[model samples]
Target: MTSPGRTERLVLPGVLTAEQAAHTVAAIAAEQRPDGAIPWFRGHHLDPWDHVEAAMALDAAGEHTRAEAAYRWLAAHQNSDGSWYAAYADGAADEPTDRGRETNFVAYAAVGVWHHYLATGDDAFLDRMWPTVYAAVEFVLQLQQPGGQIGWKREDPEDGGIDRTEALLTGCSSIHQALRCALAIAEHREEPQPDWELAVGLLGHAIRSHPERFADKSRYSMDWYYPVLGGAVTGAAAKERIEERWDDFVVPGLGVRCVLPNPWVTGGESCELALALWVMGESDRAVEILQWIQHLRAENGLYWTGYVFEDRAVWPEELTTWTAGSLLLAAAALGGDEATTAVFGGERLPVGLEPDCCTQP
Candidate 1:
């Protein structure tokens, strides 16, 4: 278990004290299996993206060994094609509940690996994970559309080969961040990936200037904030983008709504919005957002997935490590945790090259 003092950096006045942060960190650590997989809960399934997020929280709280174990779990379970299935049974090694491979889910390993590297400064670990990251990036770029948007997922053939010819605004934005991290790793190892530079540059262009290429998920708060959070949109444009939808998704003291027309606010979305806000240099607003989501925290130190504001009840009745993870990470950023801040703030990350011919202006 990580010491309570290790989580001192996660202390935020209205959100968490060091003791409270330690409790939350321990709750997540307790759910982690001996093999290092962190499911949504004890009996739930694990998804690649959320698994990485939880591991990142552990790192933020100075749980390096546990974090490294989580990465090892990912490496052990990776498909020969460089992707993991969409869902896996929590306690079983070979039991995948869902066989479809999501582009963003596969790409997210890079973000987590890069974050762990930044947190621990482990060169040998980076070298060991390099091939994994490289393979995953190649798998994701295989799904990129000609217009520079990545197809959200490749459905299982058993599901009748459903034609999923659409891209998601949120997923592509996430992949944008992952691609940058992959390039950073490449640079550190003195191995140049010219193709990745082109891929990331074009993906960023699509995200910033051509939203029409992706599916319309604007009702979801992730679409509203992810481009900015992922570092593809910046400066006055990022601020303007956030302001345009601030009223639509934000539920005042309750936090961010999962979607429009639904009176439900989610801890994960709220924390992610806080992260995007922090990326834009709006730490005050970000901290305020994090403060508002404290209502979702359960007695167990984990958080409920969402609150139905209209029903005035906790919906889903499930506590998620990812929700708590997102909160800790946002708080870590606000608290000046260097690793969390560097990974998300992204000023030091490489921006892949966008050619003159592809310039938006």
Candidate 2:
């Protein structure tokens, strides 16, 4: 792991200094179990999506071995269907707290794996993780609706029965990035996956052109920026989407709101929005967003999950690894970290073949 004064690329003006970045990295590392599972915090539940997220941050901070261990943990605990349970109890022998398997959560392993491979250039690690990525992508694609949107989750753990009544804009947009990363891995190994290409193309179309296909969660900040962040909505459309929701979600001197009509600001959502802004070539605005959220950083370098401005207090009273993880990732992107930039920038990632039946938005 990077020592103090060595996290150069993780240093952003008002976001994280070199020493502060190292401390944050160490804080997240300290929370990881010997078995490599990273829960929300000690005695808290571990979700697969957030687990992958924290691991990606570890990689961004040059903690490659710890990141690899986190990935290995995922490979070991994955269910036979190529998915992981939505939640696992921390310090409870890896028992699942939630039996449901979410498609976006399952697909995120590919994003983390590809990020790690890019950061380390370890072909062996890529080879070891390819099957896991392949299985995960296959599992997620099984839940894809005919309209190119992904169903949120499988409610029945035994039979994998999906509700399929609604797809989430935020979740499907996230899966779009995962699909591209999965395709990149396959392409690296010279393994052609034509089906995945088609799947991704259709998913992108759905995200850009068919907002009506997803559940209506426009009140949340994630739905506003995730399409651009996830690479499904890009170029001029990406800027337009951000502009549409800018006033509704951003809170100026504070951070971003988790939901509208609420004075609550969350570190995770704020940092993610900064990442999306960076993707859209708005680094100045991204830096300012990161700056606004500095008030949420705790003394030990872990960040508070959120702050409720109306109450003028930190809600839930817990510091989270994922929140800190997001901060580091967004800072890395702004500071010109190559791997983080490439992953979020989406310029080099494979765009799966577009279906001729659906016109581009």
Candidate 3:
């Protein structure tokens, strides 16, 4: 049963009719290639992370065939080592000079596949994609450092070397959630993944113990809440992290800032923050954040990438597919949808880490 508020506002409400969402879904569907890949924007290159995001959006909007095609594209293009290239151009897998493999980007497929499976309850789809997801997680784990943080990427063209630095808090946090999902998938299949459990514990440790190991990225909202959002941290500490930064980045009726005092609040980050809040069991605050972005919607359901501090819009200057997708996922979480709830696992939050990393003065 859909909540009255969700039905009123997003479904039957005057803000966005079901027909409008259907049109938006069709527009997104039209962006996919004949091969089932969706590019970041029309006439732009496609990458794994954004492709999965767009695919999940399609799934959310009831375009399952297109979503499956998008996943098939990843499976077809996956490298022998269980990874995809950093980028592709003109639908060809050309190895660019800076073709460094991003660990977090590659691991994002697990979340997407699991999400699709939940939304559709397609066990066969889950079975078919399980190996691809398993291998991809293993590939990402190869880059994990001793401190439990995975390195940013491999093969930096500028440095002409592998950038084997300590784990980034944001990347590790995201990967931590991916590992948990991968493990759950393994369990569902009656398979064992001891390696995955080890990886999860290590990454959780890094998120809890190694704040100094991360790059100095305190200004970004990702660094502020991603650990909690990603299920790498939780409980009272997660709540404190949000409360501490609440006034710093949140502009009334504008949305959350990408960076503090930087005149740029983004829909993506704000929506993710709302999701994180939901993860921490604060549904009322999460709803408030989601509603704040309502003012930022364009004539179409699409949204600008970010809003300027002057209370103006900026960057890309066009509507984005992922922006709407993020909003939909956040809304689903807030409404206690079964698919969203199952993926997030009852909102108890992950219990393996402390949230004190960003609490320092």
Q: Candidate 1 on 76-139: residue-level lDDT in tens? A: 9998878888999876664889989999999999999999999999999999999999999998
Better of 2 and 3 by lDDT: 2
Q: List the residue pairs that clash in candidate 3.
A: none
User: What TM-score, to 2 decimals, does candidate 2 have?
Assistant: 0.98
Model 1, C-alpha of 132: deviation from truth (Å): 0.7
How do the residues 168-206 of candidate 2 rate in per-residue lDDT, one tens digit apiece? Answer: 999999999999999999999999999999999999999
For candidate 3, write residues 83-200 as lDDT tens digits.
7767776445433323677888889888788878877889999999998998899889998776668888876445674666656788888888777777777877889877777777
- How far does residue 293 in candidate 3 sit from its true spot (Å)? 1.8
lDDT of 2 at 25: 95
Ranking by lDDT: 1, 2, 3
Stretches off by above 4 angstroms in model 3 are: 1-17, 90-98, 156-163, 345-361
